[model samples]
Target: MPSLINDQLPPVRHYEAAPLTKEQLDYVDLPTIDISSFTASADPNVRSQLVAQVRSAIAKYGFFYVLNHGLSTAQTVRMFDIADVPFSDVDDDEKKKYQSRLKETGTQQGYKPRQYHHIDNGIRDQIEIYSLNHDVNKSGHPAALRPLLPEIEQFAYHNHVNVLYPILRLVELHKWEDMSESSGHTDIGSLTLLYSQPIAALQIRTKDGSWKWVKHIENAIVVNAGDAIEFLSGGLYSATIHRVVQPPADQRAYTRLGLFYFVLATEDVKLKPLNSPILQRRADIWLKERFQGAEVPTMAEWRKGRTKSDGNAELKASATNLGVEEEYLNGVLIKHYV
Candidate 1:
C-alpha cells in the first residue's frame, strides 16, 4: 500500500509492455471525418463538405472519429509508452510524490490513483490517471518524463493547433460508468480527443439510454463534444455521456491505456449561449431557465469548482435537489446526469 512517510523509490528509467491482442466486439460505430480535408485546401467545396459532415455528426452522434490528424502512429504509440512511465513503471511510492491536490488546486495535472473517484454501491473507481496541462513547465513531473518534455510539448501543441483548430473551424464549432472503472458523466470542456489501444471497456450512452462500446481504431482520434459546446450551441450539439468498465473476457487481463486532450474555453469566457440566430432558434425553455437571472460562471470558476467537487462524498450525497444532481458554483447551478 502507498502511504505517507514513505522513502523515495528508485527513479523510473523506462516502461515496456506487451501489445494487447485485438478482438472483434460490439461497439458503437461513430461517424468519422477527415480533418485534413478541411485544412489542406482553401477550395470552398471541400470546406463545405467537411463542415456539413461535422455538423451532421455533432447533431446526431455527439461523437466521431478524426482521421489524418497529422500525428504519426509512432508518435501516438510513444505517448502511451510515456504514459506507462508514470502509471506503471514507477512504484506506488513514486506516484505518491505527485498525487493530485484536488482540494487545494482543483486541477487534474497530477497523479490520481485508482479508487480515488467515488462510484455507487460503495465501489471506488478501478483506474488511475495522470494528467498534464498545456503549460508543461508548471508541475514537477516524473523523472522519466522530464527528458522527454520537448516531444510531449510538441505532441500537445499538435493536438491543439493542428488537430483541434481545424476541427474547431468546421463549425467554428462545436464541438461512464463504471461497473465500472470510471463513472458515467459528460466531459466539462469544449471538446475532447481520445486515443487508445484496442480495448473494449469504453462505452457511450445512446439516445435510448443503453451503453455501447467505443471500438478503437488504429491511429484515429476519437472526438467528442462537451458541455461547453452544448451550451454555446444552445443545445444544438449534444454532450456525450460515457464511461469505462473492465475490458471484456478476451482482453480482461491486459492493461488499457488512453491518451486524451481536453480542450477548454479560456478562463475569461462566459458560459452562455452564443448570439447566433440558429442557436437562438434552438434555445429551449430549460436552456433559458439555466441562465435567466443567474450569474454564469466563467470557465475558470466552473472548472475549478467542478474538479474540487468531483470526489467529495459530502457534495456527491448533496448533489440531488428535486431529483436532479447539481452543484452551485459562482451562483450557477451545474446539473449532472449519466
Candidate 2:
C-alpha cells in the first residue's frame, strides 16, 4: 500500500485495542431535520427556523439526517449505476488508466485504486474511490466517464446552493468491502452530503468518547459538519469524528457502495474564526485553546496540508489508539483530532 503522507509516513506499527465500556458500545439516534418546509415555504420565518435547526445539530452532534432533500430515488440510483461501471464492471487494466497520481496533479480529484493503507488499522482499506471536483478542467477523471459528468455536476451544484453557498465540493463513489473499510477521521472540508446504500457500516463517535452506528434511513441523505466548518464557526460547530467499520457478521456476504458529495469553503476564503453571536458570548474558548500557539492557515493552505497529512502514522499514534479525541463546547461533547 502506498502512503498518502509523503516522507512523514511512519513505519508499520502495532496498535493495541482499548476496551470499550457498555455505554461506548451502545447506539444513539442521530437528529433528523426535515428541510422540505424550508425549500417549499416562501416565509422568511420558516427559513430561519430551518437554519436554526441545522445550526444546533451541527454544533452539538456534527451529524444529522436530512429528509425531503428533493433528490428522487431514480436520480440517486442512476448515479450508483454510473459509479458501478468503473469500480465493479471495468477490467483492472482499464481501470488503472484513471488512477490518480497526487504528486503529479497536486490534488486528490481522480480515481484512487484500493490498497491505500491507514496507520490505525495497519492494513489496506478494502475500497476503491473515484473523486470528481467542481471544476471540470481541474478534475483528472478520465474522458470515458465524461458522459455521466453532467448529471453528476448538476447534483453537486444543487446541493451547494440549496444547502450552503460559497462551498468547496467533490462527488465520490466508494466501492467498499462489506467488512473492513475506512478508519475514524474528520473530513477536511466544511460539510459532507452522503447517499449511501442500504448496508449500515458507518459509525459516529459520541460525546462520551464512545462509538455508535449511524442507522441507514432509506432515501435520506446523511449530512455532517467537517473541520473547515469548525474553523469557520470558531469551534461552535464541531467536525464529527466518524468511521466505516466492518458490517455485522450476517452482512459479510455483500459489498457496500457509497456516493458522497463533500462540501467545503471556497479556496481563497480566509478561515479565521467568524464573529457570530454564538462565538461572541462564549469568548471562543475552544478556538483559542485548539490553536493556542499555532499560526492559522488560509482555507487553501489548510486543505492542501490536510490532504498530505492524512494517514500519518505518527500523528495517529499520538492521538488516541482509535484515532479520536473528545472536547466539550457549550455543554455539548464534540469529537475531534481524528
Candidates' C-alpha lDDT: 0.71, 0.61
Candidate 1 residue-wise lDDT, 206-270, digit = tens: 88777788877889999998877877767778788777777877777677777888888776666
User: In model 1, what is the error at residue 33, expressed in angstroms?
Assistant: 0.6
Cα deviation at 147, candidate 2, in Å, is 1.5
Over 4 Å off, model 2: 1-26, 103-106, 165-182, 280-287, 319-338
Q: Number of the top candidate by TM-score?
A: 1
Candidate 1: where is the Cα deviation over 4 Å? 1-24, 170-182, 282-286, 291-293, 313-338
- For each of the candidates, give the backbone clash count: 6, 2
lDDT of 1 at 274: 80
What lDDT score goes with residue 199 in model 1?
A: 68
Best by lDDT: 1
lDDT of 2 by residue, 6-77 (tens): 344222221211222222334568888887787688898887787777777877899888877766765556
Q: Give the TM-score of candidate 2.
A: 0.78
Q: Each model's TM-score, in the order given?
A: 0.84, 0.78
